[model samples]
Target: MATQTPREAPAQAGRRLDLSAPWWSSPRWQEEKRRIRGELAALEARITPRRRLRAVIRTLARHGLLRLMQDRRAAAPSAGDASHGRHPHRDPDRRLRQIGRRLRLAFQELGPAFIKLGQVLVTRQELLPDPITAELAQLLDRVPPMPFPYLAVVLDEELPDGLQTFAWIDPEPIGSASLAQVYRAQLRDGRRCAVKVIRPLVDKLFQTDIANIARLARRLQRLLPPAVAASSDLPGLIRDYYSSVQSELDMRIEARNTREGRELVEEFGTLAVPEVYLATRRVLVTEYVDGWNIKDFPVDFFTFEERFERMIDLAHLYIKEFLNGRYHADPHGSNLIVWRHSKKVYVIDWGMVGRMDALHTEAIFRHLLHIRLNQAEDAAEVMLDVFEPTPYTDVGRLKDQLRSLYIRYVDTEQAGPHNWGHLLVEEIRIAMDNHCRIPTGLSLWAKGWSAAEGTARWLCPEISYHTVVESADVQILRRLLARRFNYRANAAWIAEASELVATLPRRLNKILERAAWNDFKLPVEGRLSEQATRNLNRMVNRATLGLISGSFFLGSALLAALGGGALDRIPGLAAVTTTALWGSLGVGVYTVWRVLRSNKA
Candidate 1:
């Protein structure tokens, strides 16, 4: 009856007419679904080409900017170039000044990333030629400050209350760098602080630039000569560059570094680090330090004694941190300041710090010790242990070079301002030339030392880095010895003692047997005691007599045994035997008397 009215099926009620499985569960439908996913993935993969194209364009733009700046420099010839034509006899100082000025201008125009690159280049004399490195050293944190509106926005985002959190913030920044700018601010609590604000979009821009540079570096590595590529370590350098810049971008890391550094150097009493107030991914707030930056201070500001004392304190700070295995990686003049009132030196900007493991620290300590003792061979060995040698390295040649370095820089009879920093830099270069891989941290440490030395020399040219190192070594040794004796003997000492005790019996037995065989020899020096001399003489006489008596006895016994031979027929045989026996007896009695007399005495 329902079939008669087909429309009355009630639209198939609640269930479908065909009760098939879901499409996704069907094998054919699943295969089609996978094909769609594969198509989507292929489309996603196509986006990479667009991204690569964008990267290429950005790289080309950077190259164009560099080329434009270089062309401008070439167009504007120096006075020497204009006058001399083919071979200009230019004053070296003037030429360097011109180059430095041009380089600084170009870096400034190329923007923050290039400026940072230039700053890093200043510390890498091994990677760049001297002129280029010297020119790059002029690069400073003189970037144009971000507009107050944008900075306020950043502040608002970082601190929920925005600029209202501070009583007053200087619109004009005190210092401006590539990634961040520092402004003087007073908190609502009336605490003066330095506010460091990371520039907007710097992270994204740096990421893009660094990626392009890394890709370019890889390409260049393939094109470069084998020796040049090996020596440059382009990949490693790029990686380190990326890591350091990224770390700098994260202000929280710098804050942590600052706190750790403060704790590490707090024992010096004369050294201090600014107290951190707030730290975030892009912002850092620290106690406002009012002091003269070492770079800006006049040489005459401090008296000779004051400068010398400061030098000593500075040296101690660096040496202690180095020996402790954590050191400020960048101790340039701008990063250091001297408080006029307290005379305390404040180290600021703990962005780039270095760390050495215990083994590295111990190796460095040993190296310093060897240098102090003028043990070139030991120093060379320490260096070898620290550096990874390549197959092409000639260890003997490396040692000879190190010996020469020690003699020239460390072994001079007269104490002078020997730049240990420069010496270390040279050592790194030598190791590189020898195909030895010097730790990058060591290079950074050496750069810091060089910068410190330069700053010290600027303040007082007469200050001797070598003297500071020697004095530091003495202090370190004294402290080490004190610590060593402060505690009771450790398990190591106990173990050594136990070993000695265990072997004592064997050693004593060997000595006694040697003495019994008369094979023992005593090493003597200086003066001999009267009893000792007398005993030695008596023992010699007894030994002689004993030998003679033993020979006589043996001869007599042989003659007696051979009585049936020709000698038995001789009439004097009995007399000879009797004489030998009487002589032997007499000698034996005399020997015994001498022994008894010596014992009585």
Candidate 2:
């Protein structure tokens, strides 16, 4: 949070400390301080933010992305610049794809923290372009699995009985990701489950990378524009990510989240989380889900209706649970699997989730409902009210842009897909472009929504996520409105109203007394209207021109009349004086006409 210096402490600190004593001649306290300083110096040398930053740079440079990362503001290559077949260089799309590949590689090389960052960042389609986000979305936890022996070491250290508690663990892991590796196992009680053990040293690496991540975000932000306003806040995003990742770091939290998720989705029989058996910081045992991820689901064998229904359930899960305050953040294909032959949607991941309060829940609900009703201005207004404004923001322009996007995308006549996630993102993106800053919490939740819609798209390309959720959105909005108007919900408003009514007579008397004394004054605050402003400026400029022209005309006319003697002596002089008078008069008349025309306009 504060700046670092190369010195042991600071010059000011030395003024307040006993740093004057040499180590050998020092008193007990001074000797202790010197010893502590030496240890601190050694530790700093061994592990420092600078060292981690260098590793990041080296990895990026290896992937040929260091320059690209620094030059984030560079305009993307245009299609027109690229030649066709047998061209000397690649097209813009091709180049973008290449950059995405390189970025994915660099993130993988950066360690778990960066890989996780990339994974989460991809969900923010509003900020990142599609080609890049597509590649990053594919940046899975492809880290090589930690050996079973090493995992056993961790299990032995964390578990009371270790391997003995499990009837048996498959030596081969069923799932290996950046954070943990999962294996099929059985408890002594004959309960079959998946054992998820944190990979050795990953926790340490993630902690280190997370610290360096803040530094990296700071450096990258410097390489770009000022933080007037942005669709994405790099430092804030990193901090939010750190908090979310922190929860994942603890297995107990994940278990609690899973339990909570299961309870929320209990109404939908097909949608559920794998049962948690044993939970610990280093390990978690849960019922092993056997199903096909949406990506690999047998599309040919299943009907679109089945897929659509399952997706609806997922959407309801989010919409309903969001109001309740928690929903699975990452509902991507891998995280939620489809039953092998059935269309049951099983949510299996709970390490990360999104939450909302009454304000945000209502804001989001109303925004969506208003957009559905084609009340673009109201939706735009809702956003304007929720987000904090930044220096770059133009309120009028933001409203205009958001209104245009809403009308363009929400055409019921159009058969083309209208992605709800992209629509939401566009709202944020336009707001950001006009200096409307979205809070980090909202941004994080928006990404989760984006991922959910992306998965929905995969399942029902014919019926988009928006179409499926539209009806549900209406119901949710109705409930929201009901609650908003409920007596208990409006207690403060009712109290304020009652006070106003009770004091009405006294307040009116005061106003009447002031009016009787002729001392009442009304205050008005207004700005120059565009039309008025233009007319006022025009009048001032024309008046100035007319004044100068009129003076010239009068002077020329007088000079012409006064040049009688000179004219008799020199005929050319008389003619020149006449021309000057006529020209000045014409200019004066023209200036007057312009002023009149402007006033009429």
Candidate 3:
């Protein structure tokens, strides 16, 4: 990402063997993306609501994705739009692949927000078909770069000293993708740095697009069946991801991420992070990490053994850093480099970062470690302790599901560095299934692992990710255990404990005195809450009804037994008996129905 190289061909273009290549390169997709760029209506937004809606439908149709909207068993809505849907494609893989291609095309056509959505979908790999992830791969990085002139205007406006702040700046971008463009420059003091400028007006664009996306997600939530809606809380997922995307829009946040990373790596000899020089809402100035992008780093520079060592070192470095509560969320090849001379790894582009509190990070480690030790139930307990279950969350079901995952993990062959990334993803899927709103920190943690593990794979395909992490686990645990014994870390806890001990005897004596005086009574919650009151009133009403019915029966039976004691006052005792019996039966049936309905509600 810190090189002078121009953007390369789209990864899809070079993937001839990809199941998605045909749809990706199709003229239809190109036209769909370019066609129908509607201007926003003047009324309260950056995009016209109606045009955006139609454009979505049209794009979905063009890509044969409208079928997703229509009832699956029903006939296609339009022959042109649902051409592929009719096939039913007896081969499930082909059907999924086709759906994946169409969905990717539809997302691309919908613009930046949807493309970003596809990127999120790929991250939940366990929840998606491989075809889907493969087709929608690396979308965040694939957002087309904006023209340099516009970005330069942003730079001049956002920088305190204007263009004169930099001794010289190469207008040509060293890297550009997602939300910003990177230009190489030298500060007034002659320290070479990278100037990252947010793409002009992207803030407004993302704002408008995300608003529309939320609208769509809401509609999907309502329109989809209960089972489908529960399986994927579209609105909830969009909200979580968009919150992070919104954070990414502000360059100051990215600068802060860089600053935090810089601090963590200061003590790491093998790892380096760019130092932040200056930051603004729209611009970031940081030390220019001089190295070849990891993917393109020359093969001749290191021996296989050295490459393996660096890979292990990189993995270990992130493990420690993440446990400390900050991680580079997108450590892909482009955001990483190998220093030309020092041979150390340079982590660049700290824009997309994930952070967790110490407790959560410790929980994640404990969860994984339990799994490593083959204590499936303990691992489940560790995670369940952290998961925040929802109204729909079945704790028992969640337990069963988590245990099943453990079983699968045990049965499956281990591949790809012990597959911690895989486990994180599975947890996410399980969380979603049970309506557990896991902290964003966990999502970011998983993202960090996925990207880091992937970059490790790219550097040394034979690298042992699990083995590296096993050693890392020992070190990580050691550091945590040592922190517990640190006086500084436990000062507040020790103070609290001391106070509690000092007050113990006094508190106990007061309790005993009150007990002897018959003044110490357990405070029990009264069964007089609003709901409890309502239930009591309903019971009283039912009892009164029964009392009235019994009185009527007794009166009628006495009258009949006395044989018209009132001397012709009651001529139809049989009719009276039948009416009372039927009426009482009706009342009892109604009461029973009411009780059942109330329980259901």
Q: Give the winner by TM-score.
A: 2
Query: lDDT per residue, candidate 2, 1-601, as tens digits?
Result: 0121113222232121121223212254334445555654574455556687788888888888867743343334445654445443444455666788898888877667887888777766667777888788777645666555556556756888755677655666777777888877778787878888887666667778888778778888777754442544679878888888888888999999989877888888667778898899989989877778878876585776676677788878877867765777777778987766455677887887776667876888777778878899898888777677765466788788888887866653213445566677777777666766676566557777777777777777777566777759666867788778988879978899999999999999999999999999999756565568877887788778778877878877887777678778985877777777788788888887875775652
Off by over 4 Å in 1: 1-86, 89-107, 228-232, 298-303, 411-418, 478-601
Weakest lDDT window of 10 consecutive positions for candidate 1 = 1-10
- Highest lDDT model number: 2
Q: 397 in model 2: Cα distance from truth in Å?
A: 0.8
**Candidate 1, residue 505: how far the Cα is off, in Å:** 32
Kindly give the stretch of ten consecutive residues in candidate 3 with the minimal lDDT sum: 1-10
TM-score of 1: 0.64
Assess candidate 3 and give its TM-score to the true structure. Answer: 0.66
Candidate 3: deviation at residue 329, Å? 1.1
lDDT of 1: 0.71
Residues 123-200, model 3: lDDT tens digits: 667567677687888466656666554554566568877666776666566776666778777887879889888775
TM-scores of the models, in the order given: 0.64, 0.70, 0.66
Q: What's the lDDT for all of these models?
A: 0.71, 0.72, 0.71
